[model samples]
Target: MVRIKQRYILFDILSPPSSEHWEAYSESRDSALLHLHQVSSSEISAKYLLQVIRQVLQDHYGDFGAGSAGISLVVKYFSPKTSTGIIRCGRQHLDMIVAVLALINRLGDKEVIMRCIHVSGTIKKCENVSIKRDKEDIIRMQRKRK
Candidate 1:
């Protein structure tokens, strides 16, 4: 008997702020506030996101990398309202997937950035972290607006 270990990656995607917003955020020194694009949400769908990731994996790592990394790949959750998602992959290709995710710069016609927030061995932990982070993000964004 063999235990097939898996890793759950919690990630978020953001669309670059419109050019007007970028000019404004860039001038402010509060780099602490990374709103360079405080995009409230986006139009990304799970199907689109999964497709982008898979394609990028193939492009950057080639067929072999894509085949191995995608063998167990699954997009577990995606919320367009939250612009967040979770993906599960085999432990062996954790770094490969992360790298491929980072390489994804655009999805559909929108320029988007995919960021890995939390990685854990269990889906529960990833979900918990994402919820907590979402709350914090809302609070932070509200404060920035005030």
Candidate 2:
């Protein structure tokens, strides 16, 4: 029996206008959290992300190459607070998925950038790393408040 291996790619979502948008959050923690939630709410959901990935793959590889790649993009976890998400796909198509991720320049006219920060074979490892990063971010933010 062949064990089907999976890969998880953790990524950060950034918009071109982030600097201007983030400036408003600098004033207060409440406002920051509120703005974070608002931005998170505005992002592309897992379903739409998958569609975009497929479209990108199609555009890059053409119909036959895309189909032959056997890509299946899945969102395992996404957190707006951290502006991070985890994607799951077969090990074989990891390159294809990464390529599509890099190729994505916009999401619904938002002019966004998706940067893959980490890739792992297990979901638990990815979750742990994401948690650690979230904690560090919180610590950094708290320090800046002082």
Candidate 3:
């Protein structure tokens, strides 16, 4: 049996800077502190994300685009606080998948921008890029405070 090559794309989910700046941090951490799960967590989950992508795929490229790109598409990780996530897709459909991601202008009711970071053959590299970007965001946030 041959293996199917895959690519992991790191993307940032950016929404308009909310009037409530600490909302993301509090929403993510408050639940953790209670050791309880929020019934409808404010976090943008992978499942919902996949559904949106599939819907958009169908809208833009019809069933063919959705089927071809949805083969192995998945949101690997999503941190609402930082608004960052990773998605895995088949290598053969990288272009179409990325286009779908770029085409995504909103998630739910909120208007958002999806920015593609580094696309890598390995999830580890994609993860590294995710961590590095998070760190930069933290630093930038800190500077604003001081």
The best candidate by TM-score is 1
Candidate 3 residue 82 Cα shift, in angstroms, is 1.3
Clashes of each: 0, 0, 0
For model 2, what is the C-alpha lDDT against the true structure? 0.76
Runs off by more than 4 Å, candidate 2: 18-38, 41-43
Q: On TM-score, who's better, 1 or 2?
A: 1
Worst 10 residues of 1 by lDDT: 31-40
Q: lDDT score, residue 136, model 2?
A: 77
lDDT value, candidate 1, whole model: 0.82
Against the unseen true structure, what C-alpha lDDT does each candidate score? 0.82, 0.76, 0.76
In candidate 3, what are the lDDT values of residues 64-132, reduced to their tens digit? Answer: 888888878999987765667789999998888889888998777776767788899999999988888
Q: CA lDDT of 81 in candidate 2?
A: 51
* Per-model TM against the reference: 0.84, 0.79, 0.77
Candidate 2 vs 3: which has more TM-score = 2
Candidate 1 residue pairs in clash (backbone atoms < 3 Å): none
**How well is each residue in 38-107 modelled by candidate 1, as lDDT tens digits?**
4434557777777878998998889999898988999999887667889999999999999988998877
Which residue pairs come into collision in candidate 3? Answer: none
Report the lDDT tens digits of candidate 2 across residue range 37-137: 33544556777777787888899989975785545568877766556789998888898888888999977866767888789998888888888977876
